[model samples]
Target: MNKQDALSIVETHLTKKRFEHTVRVAETAVTLANLYQVSAKKAEIAAIFHDYCKYRSLEEMMRIIETSYLPKDLLLYHHELWHGPVASIKVEEEYGITDEEIKSAIYCHTTGKAHMGKLDLIIFVADYIEPGRSFPGLEEVREMATTDLLKTAWMISRNTINFLMEKKNRIYPDTFHAYNDLTRLLDGGNHFEQNAIGNIETSSGSM
Candidate 1:
C-alpha cells in the first residue's frame, strides 16, 4: 500500500498520540531502510502497522495468540509484548500483507528476534529511536543510525536488556536472543566498549 493509504488505515486503530508515534517510526524506518539499502516502501508499511493491535483488549490478544500460530509462551510474558506478534498476524489476515519481510519486522518489533534481516533491524531501531521517543541515549542511537544500522541495533538491544535488568523486570527470551546475536555479529566487545552501554543506562528507559 502507498503511504497515505496505509497511514489512513492504521490511524483508525490508534489513539492520536500513538498514531503520531507510528508516523514518526515510519519516517525513521524509511530513512534507515534507504541508508541500509533496504526497501523503503516495505519499511514504511511495516512501521505503519507495527502497532496495529496495540490497543486490542488483553482478552482479544490472548485469544488471537491461543488460536494462531503465535507461540503460547507469549502468554507467560507481559501483555506489552503481545501487540507485535498479534499485529503481525492481523496485518496479513486483514490487509493481505503476506510479505515475510514486512510481517517479520512487525512480528519482532517489540523484543527483536535473533538473526533479524535489514528490514527488521530498521523497524526495531526506528521504533526505539524515533524522534517522538525520549529514551536515554536515544540521541546516540539516532546518530549511529545515520551510518551503521547493525551497530545501532546492537546498542539498542544491549541498553534494553540493561534497562530491564535495572527495573528487575523479566525480559522476554527473544530480547536476550537479539542481544546475543547482535553481540556476536559485532564480534563481541571489550570492557570499555561494554562500559559505553553504561552511559545511557543510568536512568530508566522503556523497552
Candidate 2:
C-alpha cells in the first residue's frame, strides 16, 4: 500500500491521540531515514503501522500469539510488547504490506532485536524520541539521536532494561540481545565515533 492508504488504515486502528503520535513518529522516522540515507518511504510506512495493534485487548492479543505461533514466552512479559509482533502479522495479513524491512521494523520497534538494520533503528528511535513523547531524559536522547543513532539505540535499550527492572517486570530476551548488539557496535572502533561526530555536524546544519 502507499503512504496515504497506510495512514488511513492505521488511523482507523488507533485513537486520536495515538494516531497523532503515529503521524509524529512517521515524520521523525522520515527525518532519521534522510539522515542515515535509508528509504524514507519504508520508514514512513513502518512508523505509520508500528502501533496498529496497540489497543488490542489482552485476550485478543493472546489469541493471536497462540495461533500465530509467536513465541509463547512472550506471554510471560507484559502485553505491551505484544502489539509490535502482532501488528507485523496484521499488516501483512490485513493490508497486504509484505515488505520484510517494514515488517521487521514494526516487529522490533517495541523491544528491539539483535543486529537490527538501519530501518529498524530509525523506527525504534523515532518511536522513542518523537516530538509528541515526553519523559525523563527525553531531551538527552533526542540529542543523542542526532549524533549517534546506534549509541542512542543502545542507551534506549539500556534504559528500557532498567525501567523493566525497577517495575519488577519480566525483561524480554530480545531486548537484552539488542542491548548487547548495540554495545558491540558502539565499542568496535573509531569508525562509529567518526560517524557519530559527522552525523552531529550534518544534523545540526539541517535540523
Candidate 3:
C-alpha cells in the first residue's frame, strides 16, 4: 500500500494524538530504514499500523489473542502487550497484508524479541526515538542511530528494561531476550562503556 493509503486506514483506529504519533513514527522509521539499509516502504507501513489495535477494547483484544496464533501467555501480562500481537494478525485479515517481515515488525514493536530482522529493529527503534517521544537516554540512542542500528536498539532495550524494573513491573521475557540479542551483537557480549554512549540515563517513555 502507498503511504497515504496506509496512513488513512491507520488514522481511523487511533486517537488524534495517536495518529500524529503514528505519523511521526513512520517518518522516523523511514529515516532509520534508509540509514540502516532496510526497506523504507516496509518501515513506513509497519510504523503506520504499529498501534492499529492500541485502542481496542480489552475484551476484544483478549478474544483475538485467545483465538488467533498469538501467545496466550500474553494474557497474564499487562494488556498493553496484547495489542502488538493482535495487530499482527489483524493487518493480515483486514488489509490483506501477508508480508511476514511487516507482520513480525508490527508484532514485536512493543516488546522486541530475540534475533530481530533489520525491518523489525527499524520499527522498534523508530517508535521509541520518534520526535513526539521524550524520555531519558533518548538523545544518546538517537545519536547512535545514525551510525549503528544494533547499538541504538540495545540502548532502547536496556532503558526500557531499567524503566520497568524501577516501576517494579513484571517484564515480558521477550524484552530481556531483545536486550541480550542486541548486546551480543553490539560488542560481542561486552558492555557499552562511557566512551561509547556517555552515561546515558534510562528511558520510561513510548515503549
Candidate 4:
C-alpha cells in the first residue's frame, strides 16, 4: 500500500492516541530513512503498521499466535516478541500488504533481529523515540539516531534488557541477540558500565 492508504488503514484500526503515535513514528521514520538513504515511503508504511496490533487484547494476540506457525520457544519465552511477526502476518492476511521491506520491518520492530537493514533500524528507532515515550536518555538516543543509528540501537537494547532483568521478567532471546549483535558494533566496552555510572551521578545530582 502507498503512504496515504496505509495511514488510513492504521487510523481506522487504531485508537486516537495510537493513530497519533503512528503518524509521529511515520514522520520520524521518514527522517531517518532519508538520512540513511532508505526508501522514505517504505519507512513510513512500516512505521504506520508497526504497532497495528499493539493494542489488541492479550487474548486476541495469544489467539493469533496460537494459530500461526511461530515456534513453541517463541510462544513461551518470547511471546512478546512474536506479536510483531504475528501482526505482520495479520497485516498481510487482512490488508494485502505484501511489500517485503514493510512486512519485515513490522515483523522485527519489537525485539529486532540479526542483520537488520536500514529501513528496519529506522522503524525500530522511530518507535522507540516517538514523542510520547518520554523515558530517560531518549534525547541521547534521538541524537544518536542521526549520527550513529547502530550505537543508539545498542544502548536502547541494553537498557531494555536491564529493565526486564530488574523486573524479573522473561527476557526475549532475540533481545539478547540484538544486544550482543550491537555490542560487536560498539567496538568493545563494558556493555552498559559508563552509561549506568553516568545515570547514577545524574540522579544523585538531580536529587
Candidate 4 structure quality by residue, lDDT tens digits, 1-207? 677887887787788998898899999998887777676777777898898887677777777777777645666764457668877888888887776667778988888766666666678888998877897778988888889877878878888888899999998777888888778757765434533311212111100
Query: Cα RMSD for candidate 2?
Result: 5.9
Residue 2 miss distance in model 1 (angstroms): 1.3
Full-model lDDT, candidate 3: 0.85
Local distance difference test values of all predictions, in order: 0.86, 0.86, 0.85, 0.75
- Deviating ranges (above 4 Å) for candidate 2: 189-207
Provide the lowest-lDDT 10-residue window in model 2: 198-207
What TM-score, over all chains together, does every model reach? 0.89, 0.89, 0.89, 0.83
Worst 10 residues of 3 by lDDT: 198-207
Query: Residue-wise lDDT of candidate 3 within 1-207, one digit each (tens)?
Result: 789998899888999999999999999999987776666777888899999999999999999989877888999999999899999999998988878778889999999988787778889999999998887678999898899888788888999999999999999999999998788867574333522322322221121
- Model 4 error, position 13 (Å): 2.1
**Candidate 2 at 189: error in angstroms?**
7.8
Compose the digit string of candidate 2's lDDT tens values, residues 104-204: 89999999998787778999999999998888998999999998888889989999999989999889999999998888877774544444423322111
